[model samples]
Target: MQTRSLWEHTLTFFPQFLAALKEHAPRDATVAVIGASDGKFVLPLAAAGYRVIAVERDPLALHGGEVHLPGTAHAHATGLIDRLRLEDLYDRVQVVEQDFLGSEPLDRLCDAVWTSCSWHYSVNHRRPLAEFVARMQLLVRADGLFGAEFMMPVEARHHLVDHYTSPEKLSRHFTGAWNVLLTLRTAEFTERAHHGRLQDHTHRMGLLLAARTSDHPHPHGKKNA
Candidate 1:
């Protein structure tokens, strides 16, 4: 999906997202964005004065996808960054291609972890639900912000988002160790397949912002040791 469309259809509360990062994450902290396909969100974020590290598994995400972005044929990930001169920004947005479910974990912890519409993939590919939480714990530290936007019926995280979406149900996951900050159940959308596509689709969505509690058990951000 095009980044612009993703922003319009799903990411409605950009303000809350900013607040989460500013309040929970440290100043000049690095933001690790899961599913950072083609710097769609990364470029704007980097320009906003935060260091960004985009992680994507799709090979095309690094370069460009099969379908070029509007107004250009070489509208790949890195190409967009270079074109917009976002490359001049410090910390130089970095995009890494790796499976989030692989045996290896990230080498470093982040001040904020941004996973937009990508959590379902972890649930589908990775085994137990606890494993998914454990992985996040290791990658994110106490007081760090964890943001997500996904479809409803995340109880199993098995399939992709289609019609089932309940913010009330999804908000339950942010309790206990996590402090649920913002849970806005935005309007349902009939999104399109892609740029210039007339195919409309309906999806249930939940936007969320949560922070790991200070007494969140694990000191180093990993549990079940």
Candidate 2:
């Protein structure tokens, strides 16, 4: 049986990032996905022959279980592991079940790193946005790709939080040894009701793709004089 994610059809800018990775990184590059929910992006990367590091803390999303549907109903869901196993791609992935910020640094640098609207959740708001970006940056090797598509402010409350930010605002985190490749933002648009969103809603999203330059300095941004 084919498996699907709750966000199967959600709008995303990940394709642009993947294309960029293909052009810049090697065919067997190792990738680290920060919010790899049920393998939305992970599966495709693994299918394309890229080694993947899937970082997610939600048990239901990573391990599979019952999930509430639109109405008063629930259904069995296929988690990341099951989907990978079924596709014969389990050997290409490493699952890290932990809060990214709380977890220790990744063991080794990756050729590319990507995250999608992961840090905007309330639970992550406690940590500064810079911290999240810096951590992701730290995981990429020199000349590696770093991609992120994030939520832009839509509601009054969203404006109050730094997480609901535009691509321009997020770009401030990259400098010195980093080169901004592309940045995109979508105007507020309506989206069909999904799992957490029970009613039609409007949202603005942004994407930022950058590369750690070949002469990349320390992750902390200190360069040789």
The whole-model C-alpha lDDT of candidate 1 against the native structure comes to 0.61
lDDT of 1 by residue, 56-147 (tens): 77665555445643455543334333323535653566666687766487777777777666655534444653455456556666777777
**Candidate 1 lowest-lDDT run of ten:** 1-10
lDDT of 2: 0.90
Clashing pairs in 1: 64-76
Candidate lDDT values, in order: 0.61, 0.90
List TM-scores for all candidates, in order: 0.73, 0.95
Top TM-score: which candidate number?
2
Q: Point to the candidate with the largest lDDT.
A: 2
Candidate 2 residue runs with Cα over 4 Å from true position? 220-225
Model 1 spans > 4 angstroms off: 1-11, 68-86, 121-130, 153-165, 193-198, 217-225
